[model samples]
Target: MPAPRVSVRTRIFELEMVLAGAQPPVRRRVQVPGEIDLAVLHEVVQSAMGWTNSHLHEFEIAGRRYGIPDPDWPSQDVVDETKGKLFRLVEQGDRFGYVYDFGDNWTHEITVEKITGAEPGVRYPRCVSGEGACPPEDVGGIWGYEEFQAVMADPAHPDHDERLEWARGSFDPHRFDLDETDRALQWLAWRPLAPVS
Candidate 1:
């Protein structure tokens, strides 16, 4: 008998999450398995981009909203994100939107660059490359980020010292380490969630 083909289809997704309205474009490239759920996708993004994942997030694609549906807001159109698989809902060349921190309105433009099979012995959901540092949480969005940058650049500015202190000395808006990001992602992908007793 011929060897049966294993149906494990690993997806090599070159997903780029670009912060909306960010000049020079803060972005990251990640590869995740196609069978991953939107919940896992969210975790991968958070890990890859250095986000703390401290706020609500939602994914919008093809006019459908996917997120943890709120029972309090019964009329909202969000579906449970944990139920959908990436390969079933998306494909290469498709574009989508991910909104994190609704108050700050941190919008990310997510793009699917490529889709391919998984490699043997290689871990899934890893950050391949990226550029630019993520904005601090609750920094008041793009305009605020620009103001923060200005303050950081000019020591003579009246609020320079205060802003510097606020930012914890210096802030590099262009630093990215793929290895570090992948390391952080270990908690998100490699380990299984602890089952409830």
Candidate 2:
């Protein structure tokens, strides 16, 4: 199939993805091309949220499960994520769940805030706005993350030095770099686009 272009008729999905149960709310507002595949959308979410994509992930929308097939589970009911297109499955104001890392169970709530025509001279799947640093991978689930933060905050704690080393130096729970996140998604600009003439 030919790559879809962003034109007058081709809309964009403005999505807000929030890390479920995050204390300060790690969230991102992004614009994704209407025709992209869900598999690529997974990449977008990973980039915008600063996840390393080091673990398994899946999407649950409207009672349907979608993910890559696991060879270990032949009867797995997941529909191939690559076979699903973003625009085909969602409309404005729709909400869905995305869980990354089965163990940590980092649950994210994704909502389609609006659908609008694409703008000229702009990239698709751009991170427009966001806040809060993504929790370190393998830090455990919400409860583990909470404890990790506490440990990192108290230098006197016995585990502080070890945790800091694991985090690779000073860890700022509130640090989130918008430009950095946008830079990570810059490769998505390669998506074919042709303005309506």
Candidate 3:
């Protein structure tokens, strides 16, 4: 008998995620295993984009919401994200939305760019490229981020010194390191999670 053929569902998926309304368009290009769950995908995104994961998040695909459903809000109708597989739920060219921090409303547009077989000896999920630093957590929304940029860039601005102090002297809005993000991912494709209640 022949060796079991590699299934397409076991391949790799290249995705591009862009933070909506960022000035220069903060974006990340990542290659993730198709079999990984959306819950793990959330981790990969957080690591790749330099987010601290300090607030609630949700994914909306094909008009359905996925996340850790809240018992207190039973009407939200969110499916458990941990149960959704990437390959099974999406295909090349599909687009979805991810919302983080309901108050700040940091939204990301995620596109499935390509799907191909996994490479031997290579990590399953890694950041291939990216641009722009994530705005500080609770930097407000895009408008607030714009305001932050203005104040941070103008030392003469009244809030400049205080903003600098908050950012620990300086924050580079355009800084993005592929190696740093890749290193942070480790083997996220196989990461384990406790059962969602």
Question: TM-score: which candidate is best?
Answer: 2
After aligning candidate 3 to the native by TM-score, how far in Å is the CA of 11 from where it should be?
1.2
Ranking by lDDT: 2, 3, 1
Tens digits of lDDT, candidate 1, 1-197: 43112234445677878889976568888887777789989988888888899999999989999999999997998999999888898899999999998988889999999987656555667788888888877788888888888888898999999988888988888877778888987765542223335
Q: Which tens-of-lDDT digit does each residue in 1-197 have in candidate 3? A: 33222343367899999999998679999998787789989998898888898999999999999999999999989999999999889999999999999999999999999988766546658789999988998899899999999999999999999999999888999988889888988746443222335
After superposing candidate 3, which stretches have Cα over 4 Å from the reference? 1-9, 187-197
List lDDT for all candidates, in order. Answer: 0.81, 0.88, 0.86
Clashes of each: 1, 0, 0
Candidate 3 TM-score versus the reference: 0.90
What stretches of model 1 exceed 4 Å from their correct place?
Answer: 1-7, 190-197
State which candidate, 1 or 2, has the greater TM-score.
2
Q: Write the per-residue lDDT of candidate 2 for residues 79-149, one digit (tens) a residue.
A: 89999899999999999999999999999999999999878767787899998999999998888999999
Can you give the TM-score per candidate against the true fold? 0.89, 0.93, 0.90
Worst 10 residues of 2 by lDDT: 188-197
- Which one wins by TM-score: 2 or 3? 2
